[model samples]
Target: MTKEEREQIATCIREEIETLRETVARLEDSAKTVDLDQPIGRLSRMDSLTNQGISGKVLAESKRRLLGLERALANVDDEDFGHCEECGEPIPVRRLLIMPEASLCVDCAE
Candidate 1:
């Protein structure tokens, strides 16, 4: 891929990471905003906890994504970004655009 294209992909990943971080922060803030046992609040608070749990999962997934993006970017620097780590062939640019963290090309992945 072109250098500009690679930079654009990196920018997109960074923006996504920032957005997920904000979502996680908001979930945490909402989770802490109410008491857990008040009559009008019990079930609702539980619901908040549920949302927080989901958000926490998203947060974890986002963190994993950021790590992968870092590795992918490093691969770019090392001139190994577009090659499948497992089989040593070129990875399609389309696939990389769709999933920048992919370490294996489609054949290897399958």
Candidate 2:
């Protein structure tokens, strides 16, 4: 990748990391264990539990993506930063712009 492209990807990754951090924080609050003794209807309790489970899953995924973005940002200046780890080919700039954390080219990722 060109210097400009690498810088752009780094910037995009930073922005995404910030957004994901906020999302993860909100998810953490929503994913807390439901209080069974709250005296609500059984169905309502079930719904709360289900929402909590979904939030937990989303939180996990957001955290994973956050970590990936951090790693990509850390390595953005490396000589091989834009090269696909799986095939050792240059990854497309458009793909990197869309997913700055990607380590594999589209072909290898598929």
Candidate 3:
């Protein structure tokens, strides 16, 4: 990728990281256990638990993506920043812009 592309991807990655941080925080709160002692119908309690479980799963994914983005940001300036790890080829600039944490090209990823 060009120097300008790299810089742009870096900026995008930073912004995504910030947004993911906020999402993770919100998910953490939502993922907390539902208060079973609350004076709610059993069906409502079940629904609350289900929602909490979904939130927990989303939180885990967000955290995983956040870590990947952080690692990508740390290596954004490296010589092989945009190279596919498996194919030793340059990854597409568009892909990097959309998913800065990706270490593989589309074909290799597939």
lDDT of 3 at 70: 100
Runs off by more than 4 Å, candidate 3: none
Question: What's the true lDDT of residue 38 in model 1?
Answer: 65
Over 4 Å off, model 1: 1-40
Where does candidate 2 have its weakest 10-residue lDDT segment? 27-36
lDDT of 2 at 93: 95
Lowest summed lDDT window (length 10), candidate 3: 27-36
* The best candidate in terms of lDDT: 3
Whole-model Cα lDDT of every candidate shown, in order = 0.74, 0.91, 0.92
Query: Considering only N, C-alpha and C atoms within 3 Å, which residue pairs clash in candidate 1?
Result: none
Range of the 10 consecutive residues with the lowest summed lDDT in candidate 1: 30-39
Supply the global lDDT for candidate 3: 0.92
TM-score of 2: 0.94
Q: Report lDDT (Cα) of residue 84, candidate 1.
A: 91
